[model samples]
Target: MAKTLLIGANSTIAQALQENSDREFICLARSEGNLNLDGDLSELDDVTDINGLVYFPGTINLKPFTMLKEDDFLNDFKVNVLGAAKVVKKVINQLKESEGASVVFISSVAANIGLPFHASIGASKSALEGMARSLAAEYTNAKVCFNVVAPSLTDTSLSTNLLKTDRLVEASKERNPMKEIGDPQKVAKTIDFLLDAHKNWMTGQVIHVDGGMNNLK
Candidate 1:
């Protein structure tokens, strides 16, 4: 069986996936794999086939729309959208050749629901969700599934700035309908479910692992 490929593998959710899943993964992150997200895709050329690919690279650029500049939007897209595109392109052949292949992209709840200071990330994540749907449609015949997992604020290192103080943590939780934040392990389980091609029939779908933040009032 072809192993799953995990980009930006050092992320908290990515780490959770690594620990909780029984399947093996090929982890390639900026820090560990010497990955140059903007550079070339030659590094993964050695892999013969890829059954699963999950993009964990993302940005947390929380700033008011007025404060966000063009560069900020471009940078967020570079990480959240373009980088995933590049990685998928590089492994396109392998993913197509492999049976029951799947691709998963990480998104944010802010992409669906409006949130203050989330313009940049929201835009990029929304683009990612759109791109994932498009890719799913493109590869439907190829048997290569594509899906997205969007989550709300989670207690991760990437979100330390937002959840630094107890007040901030409580405030963030209060905004969610569940009155709680996200859990990396739980989100990882959702990703793992998508990775299972035999059990999963869903595609072009954005599974909101958020605390009912996308729909609830």
Candidate 2:
């Protein structure tokens, strides 16, 4: 049985991954969970041989680039980029222990496609994508693969603000070429695949789980 670790366990996407996964998952988060990476990760000391790591911690800071202050970009980078880097660094040794370990970072379609008021998030996620690709290159021989999953607007707690009203939801649907918002389960399934041992050959890739928003639009 491969051991998997999930950060931001309380997140809807993480919960979806847990519900759909058969492998035992050690969940960690701030305050309400097993561990908080914001402070210390000593909780991971006892855990070993981590075969997979999925980082679900992220933020959505939507504001026009002109209105965004320096702190806005910094805050988004802290959550989306720095946090994932820290978690991955902490578990890297354990990942190296597995025959074929995998790391999946949750990103956004905004990283690849331009959208108004998405500057902070897009910049941070783009950094994350670059970091993941570099790490994948460095760890390829060690069998520790890194990849990203970029999803469009999904009906999750994190996205409640975007889908608060029927009009907002309908507008989002119309914008997507698929005419639908992505489901958490659909994105979770893709993450599950990236973490599978059989997916050793598939690394350093960005999988767009959007509703045809990244390309079709």
Candidate 3:
């Protein structure tokens, strides 16, 4: 059986993926599980195996550049970039052992497009995209594929304040050609497709899961 490690198991996207995927899941979350990239995944010492990995730590504090502090950028990069790197570094051996493994990082469309007050988050996510591409190139010989998913506005508790008001919702919809907020399930399904063994042919790609928000209309 293929074992998949999920870094942010508590996330809505992670939950959706777990429910939709047939692969064996090794869930990891901050404080809730033994796997903490910030610390160590000692439990894996006993398992010695896994097929794929998905890192889904993210933040959605959209604020003006001036108001954003240095810590904001640091925190974003820590969770969005360094956090993923730590987990990947720890389990890289297992990934290599899988002989054909896939790693997915959750990014944001803000990485590609310029959005007001999205400086910190965008910069961090952009780094994640770049990092994934580099890993894909470096680990191709190891039979490990690395990629990123950049989603626009999705309905999650993290962004509930922004998606609450009718005005905010309509404005968000009008910005996208699809005229709708992205569904968490749809995004999860896309992640599922990218992580599938069949997708071994594809790597180093930054897929946009936005509802035509980054481009079109």
Best by lDDT: 1
State the lDDT of candidate 2 residue by residue for 69-182, as single tens digits. 999999899889998888887889889988789999999999998999999999999999999999999999999999899999998988899999999999999999999988
The TM-score that candidate 3 achieves is 0.94
Ranking by TM-score: 1, 2, 3
Tens-digit lDDT track of model 3 for 91-206: 89988998999999999989999999999999999999999999999999999999888889988867799889999999988888788898889889988888863255989998
Candidate 3's error at 18, in angstroms? 1.1
Steric clashes per prediction: 0, 0, 0
Model 3 residue 82 lDDT? 95
Give me the overall lDDT of model 1.
0.90
lDDT of 1 at 181: 81
What's model 2's lDDT at 105?
95
Which runs in model 2 stand beyond 4 Å of their true positions?
31-33, 197-200
Report model 1's TM-score to 2 decimal places.
0.97
Per-residue accuracy of model 1 over 78-127 as CA lDDT, tens digit each: 99999999999999889889867989999999899888899899989999
Better of 2 and 3 by lDDT: 2
Best by TM-score: 1
Q: Cα RMSDs of all predictions?
A: 1.0, 1.3, 1.6
